[model samples]
Target: MERRTISVTGMSCNGCEQNVESALQNIEGVTRVEADRGGDTVEIVTEDDVADDDIEAAIENAGYDVAT
Candidate 1:
């Protein structure tokens, strides 16, 4: 699997972590997702190739902002 660490914003609590995780996990090609509100970061594990835009969109869709 391929791992990616992404920076994000607007996450203040654990619930926000779950939301971001759920959103990213729903994306195609993604196998695992871990989000941390403390550092505003997300770590994703994917089985297939995943686009950066797709990941960013998933985070945004979950009411968070991915750092550009």
Candidate 2:
């Protein structure tokens, strides 16, 4: 599995965190997702190679920003 730590912005509460987590978890290759509101980041584990753009798009679609 490959692990990636993606910086996320615009998350204000636990609900936002959960939304981000759900978005990441829904991606095809994603095996695990950990959204941290305090840290403003999401850690993901996936079997298939995930594109950075795909990750950013997923977060953006969920109404958040991905810090490059």
Predicted candidate 1 versus true structure: per-residue lDDT over 32-66, tens digit per residue? 88898888899999976788989999899989998
The C-alpha stretches of model 1 lying farther than 4 A from their native spots are none
Where's the lowest-lDDT run of ten residues in candidate 2?
Answer: 46-55
Q: Give the TM-score of candidate 1.
A: 0.92
Residue-wise lDDT of candidate 2 within 1-68, one digit each (tens)? Answer: 89889899999999999999998888899999999989998999988688878888999999998887
**TM-score against truth, every candidate:** 0.92, 0.92
Clashing residue pairs in candidate 1, if any?
none
Cα-based lDDT for every prediction: 0.90, 0.90
